[model samples]
Target: MKTAKIHLILSCLFIFSILSCNQKKEQKIETTSISQPEMVLDLLDLQANNKLGKDTLVTIVNDPVYHKAKKYKAVSASLLVKTEIELNKIDSKNTKIVFECVDGYKPEMPLELFLNANPFLAFEDVDAPKGSKWEPILKEGNEMNAEPFYIVYPSISEKDSRYKWPYNLVKIYLEPLNKSTLELYPLKNKKLETGYTLFKNQCLTCHSINGIGGTMGPELNYPKSVTEYWKENELVNYIVNPASFRNKVKMPTLGITKQQSQEIVDYLKYMSENKKKI
Candidate 1:
């Protein structure tokens, strides 16, 4: 009887240990599933100045290379920023505004373009065209329900690299343009100069040049630029499709063309060769 009793107690203890392990495993999965933080754009702060108009009927033109266009009743990005700036007591003369998406796509729109370009932020679709590709192209995964923040630049060409239409946007920040840092353009090549502009539009928000831009990304040209490390062809492929090289890369595709990628790469090479100019 004593032996039987001891065996029964041991079996119960073993079962308990197994259950405890399973429970811990479940908790571990749950903890890892949190993903990223919910992006918050304080509408209250933006509305304080009352410059942001109501949601007006606006159309969002999808990049023609990918999908057809979609329309939405959206808010004015310009007015929203105008109001926000006024409420926050910020001077727009010297500060640059940045829009950041969840997928590491951040673009710093020139204040002139931010005001004059007349971009809109579409929160809701107007009406889907029957059998259209609009809704089908909305981002998948964590951005599945990204609403109230689809960027639209109606004034610019669809092919323009000045800015990209980014959804799942999370934050907007202000930084100094630092024209003095960017004014030094020693290279006489017009193509590389245009490429530099493209880099400023698409990359300056994350990657710093000569230690003048943002720090979210690596320094493009200081002691050593990307040209020294990443091969030219590989760099081109990486820019066009980052996921092809690394499955878990944080950098999102900025929608640059093949030619544009080449130009940007050449510009980076120039910067690498002439680091003092930057």
Candidate 2:
């Protein structure tokens, strides 16, 4: 009888071990599935069966990013927003469209700009040479793929002063602007405040000051900016002509006057003084 009991006990232990292993395997599979979600481009098409999928495609001609005027097949952002507004009866009076990228770069612009900008969601590149040297590969250390969705404005040049093109484009948020913050307009100097306005028009779209602007570029003031590292004179020169100083500075010259450049520098200094160290 004791020998029989020992055999039964061993069999029970073996079954318990197998059950535990199976549970762990199931849990791992579940976690892996939820980690990387597939990105989707929404256009608010109520009639379309696919809603905001790749079904609704538009054509973009003469794309300047590639050489030789390549053609791109994309989705018209203007059409999507218009349709959504009409279909769902959305109030676009004080609307602000936020373009969100996969790299956490969000730039919110007015709804009028969204309509006038003529932005599109480019997916497949047509008329592109396979062996061409101008293929859209990774530029910086960014690993995010610009495939499936790339925000492109055909009319605007890549070298334009207001060139705020975002690649690896993911989602779009439409909301109303109803809040005022210290960083929104920053502390303005009564006499030299044109620098502040210039900074808002040019730099504020990309670079953030005291955690209150776009997320694509680096933060300027919190922990100490380029001003703290580089000398004042050198920083001024770099701002005026970026490529002359460094081979390929991402920032482009805005053609601001010497007085304006100094104003922007002074504004940076002002932020640094008021910056709360992070």
Candidate 3:
């Protein structure tokens, strides 16, 4: 009788232990379920201000905070903005812009935070000029605002040697032609053909007018087809620093000084005028 009673006691203890273990497991699962909702909400909040979806998964992984939380460095992250546009192409009509984040970061942060509190909608009035030149209706009026604009997050990598932290942000503005502008070009009144020779010597190697030069870069004969988006100054700036516009571009600096660049521009203008005749 004592042996049977001891067996019953053992069975009861075993059942009790199993029940206790199951209860603990249920409690743990419930806690995890409750916390998961909060985590989802946090992720959604992080993605709120992303209008153009520029951020990437790689960017988030490289973040110091994320590395510390996950207890290890991330291998890679997905790129958010696959397509990129030149800075000059961004204007009032198409103000919403997306820049590919650095190689290993993710798009979990709000765009406003990434862009330093500048909204995309604010670009319309920020880059435009104040006064009208040659009547707003007759000429293409100032449509963009004058405020300095920048990429929300530019792509950066450890291998990059050119730009340091906080890449140089490009600013654009409009200026009207005045007496000073007219006076700067005294040679224009004297010899019209001087510009053409300079172009043939300097730019004829890579660039072609009406399908002439090597097919390395885009054809310059049709500036409208190449890019009607960029302003005059923007074009000049690109000619000055091709590296600033593209990452690791093959185009060399060409050592063309400012005066030479202007001469080339004049030659291009002459060519453009002649293109209408062709």
Candidate 4:
């Protein structure tokens, strides 16, 4: 009888040990995922597999790209995101939603803000002519269309500066909100805050300071900064109106004042001195 009890106790203890270790292992994995959560979604891939969720119709009173009222066949962007991943596993406040366009123009907004709004991924123009999915958009002497995908919001104001309407969008990324700020910030000079803010708002989407921005535009500070070659006054003027300096210039008129342009140039000059090889 004593021998049988000893064997039973040993087996019970072994089983309990295994269960405890497994529980600890699961807790460790959960903690790791929450600590450094990042997700990249190839929108095209998702669409190809018919995983984009239900389609619906959405209207934009004044589309920023087309400059007119527009209607499109779209899917609820927030719902797609919510279904793809566990939102509760990550901290929305510390994260951002980046829309990656085909032209390499990457624009991002706070993840919490994006989720709160009624955003949509438009896949087709409801008013487009027969045999076509999109209408031509003429801007900066270039003719293009918002093919594949475009991010839009139905209730958001067209003039709301806080929202971003990115056409030709191809991918979506959820990343740490402060990833760029940690690298591109001008920590040495407090007076350069104005320029930094302007860059973050207007330029960072296209241009990078030290290989840390969108690839749509040239890197501003790695091999050579624009300020190093162009005259300060001329650089400012060029930024305010790129079309004035060159024929069929790809860079659009940012509509910022000459002073704002100068502020951006000043920030660029500062970054030129603080170049990181990568």
Q: Which ranges of candidate 4 are over 4 A from the true structure?
A: 1-17, 28-38
Candidate 3: misplaced stretches above 4 Å? 1-192, 223-229, 276-278
Minimum summed lDDT over a 10-residue window in model 4 is located at: 32-41
Cα-based lDDT at residue 36, candidate 1: 20
lDDT of 3 by residue, 1-278 (tens): 99999999999999999999999999887565433122121212223444334422222112121111111111111122212122232222322222211221111222223234221211111112356211111112323221221222124432332211211112111112121123223244435445555555455445556654323466676544233445666676777778889876756677777666766666666555444211
Q: Order of all candidates by lDDT, from best down to worst?
A: 4, 1, 2, 3
lDDT for each candidate structure: 0.66, 0.62, 0.37, 0.89
Candidate 2: stretches off by over 4 Å: 1-50, 53-57, 82-91, 102-108, 116-118, 129-146, 153-165, 175-182, 276-278
Ranking of models by TM-score: 4, 2, 1, 3
Give each model a TM-score. Answer: 0.51, 0.61, 0.29, 0.89
What candidate 1 gets wrong by more than 4 Å, as runs, is 1-53, 61-66, 87-94, 128-134, 138-148, 154-156, 179-198, 205-278
Q: Against the hidden true structure, what lDDT does model 1 obtain?
A: 0.66
TM-score of 3: 0.29
User: Candidate 1's error at 255, in angstroms?
Assistant: 10
Measured on C-alpha atoms, candidate 4 has an lDDT of 0.89
Candidate 3 vs candidate 4: the TM-score winner is: 4
Q: Score candidate 4 by TM-score against the native.
A: 0.89
Which TM-score value belongs to model 2?
0.61
